[model samples]
Target: MRGEAGLPPVDMSVKVGPLALPSPVLVGSGTFGFGEEYAPYCDLARLGAIVTKAVTLRPREGNPGPRIWETAAGMLNAIGLQNPGLERFLAEKLPPLVAAGHVVIVNIAGHDVEEYVKLAGALDAAKGVAAIEVNVSCPNVSRGGIEFGRDPAVLGELVRAVRGATRLPLIVKLSPNVSDIVPLAAAAMEAGADALSLINTLLGMAIDARQRRPRLANVTGGLSGPAIKPVALRMVWQVWQALRPPIIGMGGIMTGEDAAEFMLAGAAAVAVGTANFVDPTSASRVAAELEDFCRGQRINHVSELTGGLQV
Candidate 1:
């Protein structure tokens, strides 16, 4: 609808699975830090949603020293999903998040199918938890690692079991290390995932040639940043062509144009990750820039960018 000035007020709202968001820009888990770290940097309520770092049934110490390393165009980290366990998160972090008025989506990880179910059930009862993002694609863990995200059949079972355990919207985060991502996406949706977040992180490593040692203590870590943007867009486009579920496209989104590229490639929304390290308000910046872009292009709404790519 046009505003008082007659130009259409860009509608940035988007629905992913069952959750409705005010804007299409969300902060990726791990980077945003439960919405508290950046609360002063940007308005958390202005974002579509904030996905917290992966929380487990038990607290994790994460990986050893040198867990993060900077590369040419991106950074690699094998932080190993360090997070306060679900119980502590509920007792401490969650209340403030809700009180701060931010829409929260808890990202959960598990060592096994039963663990996933247990986490889902527990989070379902937590107040102020908007949804659950199943972190099946972390490459740093020894148990239940990327294996759960790589196998189509196994992923299906996991999703189905998680579905049975919770009533909240389920978003199965997909791994980019797979041979083909389409089948993995299909399996997740078929197993009852309400939405999907694609291209978690590409498996990569940085080495110190002179020292003959890996830059990261874990030797390898998930690669994220502008380096993976093209790969992410391709996968989002592939899944968008074959699936009807909303996708939270993420990987190397650093700017408004990058987010728009993902949207045009078929993402219902985009998540900002690595850029957060450079600027805490990257998500809000992207959203503001996106609106400016829509105005310049005469696009009535940002949602029109979704799947608007032409051959």
Candidate 2:
């Protein structure tokens, strides 16, 4: 038991190929700021990793106003991958976050494969980027968005190019909006991916019948939070069984039980996304509950439960 630190004795250290995480509760890419915004609400070091909001080659002003839509069990957002781009991130945002002890990861988006490679190379040299989460899967925005993630060929080539660019471990986030995940997962592995993170938010929308307008100004946004948990779980289980690489799973996980189910299904770690926006303490609570679960189950290390299900 790690005493006085609110950590349990389960020893939840996880390794993604060569990268390591302290716990299984990682804050999701788009929802969590560059490991800074959540600082006031959380002990950033307590997380498995902190994935910054999706960063692009050039700074983004993000989508037009009214980008969020609230629903019964979740939220839909088309934040449009708002970021300060690589140069500004390195110069202005990254240093303090990492120095504060958060395990830093740069989540990168690109308009093309070459852009990904360039950003990867840049982050590889930037101070304190522990890893790179390739977001070739976001579907909310237009342009070279979900196209790269849906096709196995494009996915493979893009991953290979970025893999070639950085010395840091690669975690390619996969979109669930695909016909089949196996081929794409296979393509990523063959392209030198060190790890795989699955189930970027599914495409969804809400409408105001009276006003005859979409709730979100973007019309369609990526769905996340409680409502998508089942879909996320099924995809994580399928990809975990199909692909041999270590997996980081996420979708609608808001509770410790939700997080634990993903772990049982084969996720090496779970990212708590939409819940962060709903309940700032959601991630921390899940982490606590997971530790309690391991204790009750008599498991010493959380890694022992990784893909532990028997076929």
Candidate 3:
């Protein structure tokens, strides 16, 4: 098919393991609500997928007031996995996105292995779910409330158990708070994760010097946005070099060039997170911009940009 200005269409389709996405640009979970909320501002179908916010077994009230604080070129959030829980999500959230023909990748979190198993099993039968993204950044109550992604063993066990519960493709979202990300990425892959999502916000804190208090009520929150882009890119490069697992790269991506940077570093797909807050149409815009980038580079397929970075 011919593209804009009589140029040949740049193939934008990508396969993150078993999941085939029409575009490489996906709106990150928690940033884009269940998918329908941004319909008026952007075309949901034009994007790769809509990764829904983290859902747990039970409803969570999230964190106290001032859960979000804006910082230099980024933002800190301790939303505490706030959601309406599984039942409501399957009933209320999933249907609308599916009805709208949006590829829905549900992000799930839990306090322990059993909860994750239960969630995976439940979602296995839920129609319209394209895949399940295991958010290992959540606390594991059985492990003294430490984040599941912090330990390679714990993350592997979690992924293994979830893998057994469902036949759906599994995407493990890794935390960037670790000392080295390669071990955790290897563990997830060995445990049967079909794809990996890297650098899920770095741990950070913002203090109010004037009030001598923390800016966020949670004291510390996940830091995201342009400030973390370099770190995210590095991690993605390291993991890809070591394991080469299908990766969904994210962190401070605000434009097409940013997405291209991640792809060059070996991300099979890129997700837009913090940028959504600034522009609800950011995801769709990024997709278009990525196509423009591909055309400008004389690339025939977007996949050609994957791991194309030179030393």
Candidate 4:
């Protein structure tokens, strides 16, 4: 398995629960659009997986003006989960992705338990959907976003409902705005989640000091990028220690070293988020860099990096 540049043969494939990824790097939902938005800039099929934007039961116009605000090391977004709904995604967006031979993971959000179940069942019949990332934590939405995610009972119920709906690999995406993430992580797993993705943006806001107003129309938005790396890493590490499920660590993953750090912190895989907005090919590049990282460390398989942290 000698890699490109004739370095030591390194294996990047990882088992994300029942899903086997060819690489440890994946594109985070929302940031990568419908998994094809960045295809013009990079090869979507090259990455381990692509998590599509938050798909809902109906179309949403998203939030009002100034949905995104740039900060020091990160950005705040209150996109409001605007999407073309399931029918449109299945009819128009999904075909090209499946045709491109890429591993597609559809991420869905809902205002209630039944919505999640319904959406899951709908995506189940899609041809190329490799998995479903349940977005229980979305700061942008008002009804069923972070509200359901913060409550262990609600989160468990939602996971269970969605689990019963689809046979696709279910990955519960957890929120970071909770007091104890361990319980929530355990709840999802106990309710029958095959995998987990952690730190789906922290609740944050930016104030326009000059105008004496909020930077974003939604006032508070989900914070992501380098600023949230430490928080994301800590949560992923805690969840991995507690649940030991296949975890996809995301939030502030911008480079290959960052992705490697997530794996070392106990993530089976890592997703590129805000970095995609900065560089469309970030995910693919991270995958390549991870291979070089393994070769440099004399590690033959990338899976060895999971929970490899000495401390």
The number of the candidate with the highest TM-score is 4
- What is the overall TM-score of model 1 with all chains considered together? 0.97
Q: What tens-digit string does per-residue lDDT give for candidate 1 at 108-195?
A: 9999999899999999998888999999999987885588998899999999999999999999999999889999999999999999
**Tens digit of lDDT per residue, candidate 3, span 1-311?**
33888889999999999999999999888898787678899878779999999888988788786888999999998888888999999889889888888888999888889999999999999998999999886431222124788889988898999999999999999988889999999999999999999868888989989999999888888889999999999999999999989999999999999999999999999999999999988998999999999999999999999999999
lDDT of 4 by residue, 47-141 (tens): 99888999999988899979999998999999999999989999999898889888899999998888889999999977889999999899887
For model 2, the superposed segments whose C-alpha errors exceed 4 Å read: 1-8
lDDT values, one for every candidate? 0.89, 0.85, 0.89, 0.89
In model 1, where do residues sit more than 4 Å from their true spots? 1-6
Give lDDT for model 2. 0.85
- Report each candidate's C-alpha RMSD, comma-separated, in the order given: 1.7, 2.1, 1.8, 1.3
**Against the correct fold, how does model 3 do in TM-score?**
0.97
Provide the TM-score for each candidate, comma-separated.
Answer: 0.97, 0.95, 0.97, 0.97
In model 3, which residue pairs have backbone atoms overlapping below 3 Å?
225-252
Error of 1 at 244 (Å): 3.0
Give the CA lDDT, 0 to 100, for residue 26 in model 4.
89
How many angstroms is residue 68 displaced in model 3 relative to the true structure, after the best TM-score fit? Answer: 0.8
* Angstrom error at residue 137, model 2: 1.1
Clashes of each: 0, 1, 1, 0
